[model samples]
Target: MDGFDNLSASEKAEATELQRMIAVEQQKAQFQAQVHSFTDVCWDKCVDTPGSKLDYRTETCLVSCVERFIDTTLSITNRFTQMVQKGTQ
Candidate 1:
């Protein structure tokens, strides 16, 4: 690409907006990857395959699984922070 100094004002603005859109797309992709990973693990533990679309029981279980996973993460984070504060490895 030519240097930004050679670009017209509108071209520069377009480039900047394109860069922002790319960043947003990257963030969305990363979030999707995390969700897929989480779903895979949680499905293994909670899902038994779809039986005619999602049943309420399975839906509830999946919700609980995600909630508990996040709760576990938060608990571990707090504990690790306390350990660091106390200079404990």
Candidate 2:
């Protein structure tokens, strides 16, 4: 049987809303995983050694690395979108 078939109208609406919320949370978790992966890669690439504290130079480098990664991602995504649109025409 359809799962919602047993639910009242209000319950059905609530269930649908819950499903939407779950999807949104899943997207958020996936985004966080990507960010963590990026940070790990960037950290290894940018930091030469582990320090007891974050010095100004290392902090700047990490920030720059993340920013550049984001910028590159956006640039590539935009170009890909344009290419896809052209191909569809």
Report residue 25 deviation for candidate 1 (angstroms). Answer: 1.2
User: Which regions of candidate 1 are displaced past 4 Å?
Assistant: 1-3, 53-58, 70-89
Model 1: worst 10 consecutive residues (lDDT sum)? 45-54
| Residue pairs clashing, model 1 | none
Q: How well is each residue in 56-80 modelled by candidate 2, as lDDT tens digits?
A: 8889988998888889989998999
- Error in Å for residue 47 of model 2: 1.2
lDDT of 1 by residue, 1-89 (tens): 65678889999999899999999999999878868977998888777876767788888888998888878878998999999989965
Highest lDDT: give the candidate number.
2
Candidate 1, residue 84: lDDT: 96
Could you tell me which residue pairs clash in candidate 2? none
lDDT of 2 at 51: 84
lDDT for 44 (candidate 1): 86
Each model's C-alpha lDDT? 0.86, 0.91
Off-target runs (Cα >4 Å) in candidate 2 are 1-7, 79-89
Cα error of candidate 2 at position 4, Å: 5.5
